[model samples]
Target: MTAMAAEIKKGRKFDQVLDGAREVFMRDGFEGASVDEIARVAGVSKATLYSYFPDKRLLFSEVARLECNRQAEEAMAEFDLSDPVAVVLHEAANRIVRFFLSDFGQQVYRICVAESYRFPELGQRFYASGPALVRERMSAILQPYIDRGELVIEDMDLAADQFGQLCKSDLFVRRLCGISKETSEAEIKRVVTGVVEMFLARYGA
Candidate 1:
């Protein structure tokens, strides 16, 4: 095979390993998951799995990192900077709640919660790759509103964090505790609207 074909094959193998890692990690938490099982699931030999990821820790970290980035990207994609503040907040809340309810999102949270004590670095990895990024993105959006005197806030960072916490409280807790059901649209809208109204009342122009 040509060099290009070899690279393509390598890429495909990496994807296969990631897919298998996600499955194993979700089914058996990061601490309980094993590289042998992941390789078996991926239909690859242990050596092949190692070729893609040097160890189980690395593989699990990459899987969680990728999923977190994907969730953040999905949430960011739905945001419309030109929309009204209320509309923007509501849409952001919906996206956040939806992300927490996703399978990968819930599993990532489980891994963080379960393994944080044993592998404290995993917690930091999750926070840096996920919530930290979310907060940063949210702050960027809110900063414009604050600068334009549309929203009055002592701290845009705090406001963004509170907004995300409010939107995620219920779904995130439930999902972390093993509840797989999605939040109802009506519930999400009601909560988001209430939060947005309160925020606007406190900070609106």
Candidate 2:
């Protein structure tokens, strides 16, 4: 483990600190979140919080990691790998679209973009925990179909990344630009359908 990872001391209150930090970070972003507020929200003393996370950046990284892992796992849990390629892609597309439009997702994306220049590690962690993890998961899901000669994907990584971006569609842009809030299920389905069909048209064998 790296020095930063080693410095993190997990204990009974470890999850408590992460949960509190997630809430504060989501609400206030990276720079705006305060150690005092995190400690207060966690119901732990400053010393206790510090013992678990020596720096606020470390705490934020941990929160983003856990949240991203949780989302990726949750999205994969319902997936039936045995299903048709399009069916599975649709499921993945739906989950990705919803997540991109989620408040937590938007906040994390904004924080990473805003703080990444000053704290490069912050952006690296976000990409590793979020986009990289999702790409790996997508590749895993697609591999079975490729072996069966159902999907002809020579560049699995690029295919996975493309699928993710396709899921964004107009909805992600509109939401990010404050053009829409509270997207309807019909709208989400519209995007998901388009992504799966387009992706399959390109890669399906």
Best by TM-score: 2
Clash number for each model? 0, 0
Please provide, for model 1 over 20-83, each residue's C-alpha lDDT reduced to its tens digit, 9 standing for 90 to 100. Answer: 9888887887767888899999889898887666646557767878877776677678777777
Per-residue lDDT tens digits for candidate 2, residues 18-120, read: 8889889888877789999999999999999989888787787788788888878887888998998888998899889998999878777777787788777
How well does candidate 2 match the true structure, expressed as C-alpha RMSD? 2.8
Give the TM-score of each candidate.
0.76, 0.88
lDDT on C-alpha atoms for all candidate structures: 0.74, 0.87
